[model samples]
Target: MGLFDNAVPGGNITKPLMIALGALLVGKMLSGKSAEQPQEAPAPAPTPAGTTSADGGLLGGLGGLLDKLRDAGHGNVADSWVGTGQNQSINPGDLGSALGPAVIREIAQRTGMNEQELLQQLSTALPGIVDKLTPNGQVPQQHQVASAFNS
Candidate 1:
């Protein structure tokens, strides 16, 4: 008998034929789809005005600020500024409103600098301090006031 005829026991081709057919069927199933067809997935809804993509409104701004605070190792400032007890909570929105007066008082208490001198020095150093905080030369004027106090 030839080598090809004796390759399988009893010269049966049925098993080999079935195996080839099964492989072909599997190949057809896997490769039959066209690449041009678009996949369907659920679309995300639009965000409302004054809202962040992930969360809503002012809370998003506070979340971003908290990240910056952690990076700066000054997270205690947020807790100290907002936590209960002798240190009254100040709204993030009102931080600018309270900054100038607070800076003057803090300077007076810590450095024994008079209010007028503190104000004068702060006013002089304010613009450079602001430039350092911002990417470009511009910082929002409201943010500049608070940043000056922080510096």
Candidate 2:
């Protein structure tokens, strides 16, 4: 095991799972508002940020974020979250490096949580959260990813 290697055995997570977990936590910041409830003003559906596949279509950003992590050499940890069997735990420090500064800053700004706090919360939630998302022991498709957030 090295810097970007999966810290736990049989652990698996993926881009979609991590991004969804982060987004889910951010959404949870809305003071007791359950994401499952219908809202007074329904949120806008996700749209592509640009003409790219990894831009912004609801979960598009998340998908892109996952790509970044994989590119950063944390794919194994991410995949473990999506893979079958036991999910792995992540080090908050490693997460910062895997996601890089820009993305971390963006998430921090959006969630209104400091970098360390956000990472800490994300680390705790990500493992179990992603496990739930990939119940079939496989990463979900783009549409399935988006639908989970919408509902």
Candidate 3:
């Protein structure tokens, strides 16, 4: 119904996780683009290299994450978040499995969070973040995503 329908439950820990994830995804989107391809959307100022990592094979940005979710049999859940519908909740364990070990490990390392806690926070935050990012029930252009992130 509302954005963040699955609101993150904890304080302090949650903000950094969202920031880390958002920064990583945005960095991937920017860096993955090439000189040959026409820039589809304007980009925000480049992020610091230290904040971005090629950790999860998230080379394709949110789409790559969606692909991983679909491959892990969470297509419906991913779709629900992308579509104009109620966001589907994911179990933390299921979320971990969908993201796989490399991603989880990388995220944990970056966030200074334990695997279990990272998964728990991500499971709650991701759907809402995806929902917010895809406000029109579709993946937005890169500039649009950057704007959303900026806001």
- How close is every model to the real structure, measured as TM-score? 0.26, 0.59, 0.69
Question: Which has the greatest TM-score?
Answer: 3
Clashes (N, CA, C under 3 Å) per candidate = 0, 10, 0
lDDT of 2 by residue, 1-151 (tens): 1211343233443333333353433332222332433332334323323312222432344455456557778878777777886676789888777666655665554444678887876676666655655667766665665455445
Off by over 4 Å in 1: 1-102, 137-151
Q: Which pairs in model 3 have colliding backbones?
A: none
Evaluate model 1: give its lDDT. Answer: 0.30
Candidate 1 C-alpha lDDT tens digits along 12-48: 3332222221111111211122122123112322322
Candidate with better TM-score, 1 vs 3: 3
Give me the runs in candidate 3 sitting further than 4 Å from their true place: 1-13, 28-59
Give the Å error, residue 31, model 2. Answer: 17
Better of 1 and 2 by lDDT: 2
Candidate 2, position 10, lDDT: 38
RMSD each, Å: 32.2, 9.0, 9.2
* lDDT of candidate model 3 versus the reference: 0.63
- Better candidate by lDDT, 2 or 3: 3
Positional deviation of residue 52's Cα in model 1 after best superposition, in angstroms: 23
